[model samples]
Target: MMDEAVLEALDAYVECLFAPQDEALEFTLSASRRAGLPDIQVSPAEGRLLQLLALMVGAGRILEIGTLGGYSAIHLARALPDVGTMVSLEASAHHAEVARANIEHAGLSEKVEVRTGDARKLLARMIQDGEEPFDVVFIDADKRGYPEYLELSLTLSHPGTLILADNTFRGGAVVQPADETSRVLHEFNLSLARDPRLDSILIPVVRERVDGLSIARVKNI
Candidate 1:
């Protein structure tokens, strides 16, 4: 297995080759840092992967459970066609403000909406309001919230919708699952695999450490 340094170098090599950051993306990271946001946003390579997945699915509408400084949101929104739109849920009002500013700076304000509130409550409200199904749902929030997020995301997805969750491997913790978060993530992966309405797989992603992105396509319902 590659050491952390090698893994990071490999990630940088991939990002340099295929996901070079633009001015907007650069500004997003800088602003996010200035605002003291956690540096837990997806890496550049993973952001590219998200964009590619969104494009591959021909996503017209996307839903994101986390909007950390709008870094990933910019990537996902860029994959949208002119009329395509996205709604991103952020639990922290401060983070939402930062994300909105970053998105605006990225010239994606018209395409993405960053809503601030409890994700579960917002999702429940969306369901109650009969929100239109999205073509893609990306969850990258609190690990403990993943199970409920997945269930809520399904309510907002249609057949063929793509659901992506980040940090699934949890630095290999899910392998042994000594902690509650790790155990929960392990079970989440299992549920994704066994769910009759979907077909899924966990794609390993490398940064400073090995994590995973869980991708599932809604087969029915």
Candidate 2:
């Protein structure tokens, strides 16, 4: 197995060749750093991967949980058509503010809406409002609540809806989780994979952090 540093260097090299970060995205990252947000945002390659996946699914209405500085939101929004829209749910008001500004900087203000509230509550409200089913949903919020997020997402989705969950691997902890968060996340991963309603795969994305992403498509409902 390659060392983490070597793997990262290789990933960086591949990103330069396949998905170089553009100026707007660079500015978004810069703004996030200036705002003192955690650098837990997806790497440029991961963001590009999300964009490509969204494009592949031909997503129109995208839903994002955990809009930290709107970094991933920008990438997902960019994958949409001119008329496409994305609503991102964030629990932290301060983070949401930074995300909104960063999204504007990325020229995606019209395409992305950063809502500040508890994700579970907002999702419930969306259901009560009878919002249309989303084409794609991305979950990146608290690990302990992932199962609930999956349940809520299934409620808000339809057949063929793309569902993605980030940080599934969680620094290799899923293999032998030592904390409640890791154990729950590990269970969530297992549940997602075993669920009959969706087709799913877990992909290891090697960045500064050893995180994995889960992509699932609703099949029967």
Best by TM-score: 1
Model 2 is weakest, by summed lDDT over 10 consecutive residues, at 1-10
Per-residue alpha-carbon lDDT of candidate 2 for residues 53-114, written as tens digits (9 for 90 to 100): 99999999999999998889998999999999999999999899989988888889999989
TM per prediction? 0.99, 0.97
- Residue 210 lDDT, candidate 1, scale 0-100: 89
The C-alpha RMSD in Å for every predicted model, in order, reads: 0.6, 1.1
Clashing pairs in 2: none
lDDT of 1 at 193: 97
Q: Please list the residue runs of candidate 2 whose C-alpha ends up more than 4 Å from where it truly belongs after superposition.
A: none
**Residue 171's lDDT in candidate 1:** 91
Best by lDDT: 1
TM-score (C-alpha) between model 2 and the true structure = 0.97
Q: Candidate 2, overall lDDT?
A: 0.91
Cα error, residue 110 of model 1, in Å, equals: 0.5
Shift in Å, residue 149, candidate 2: 0.6
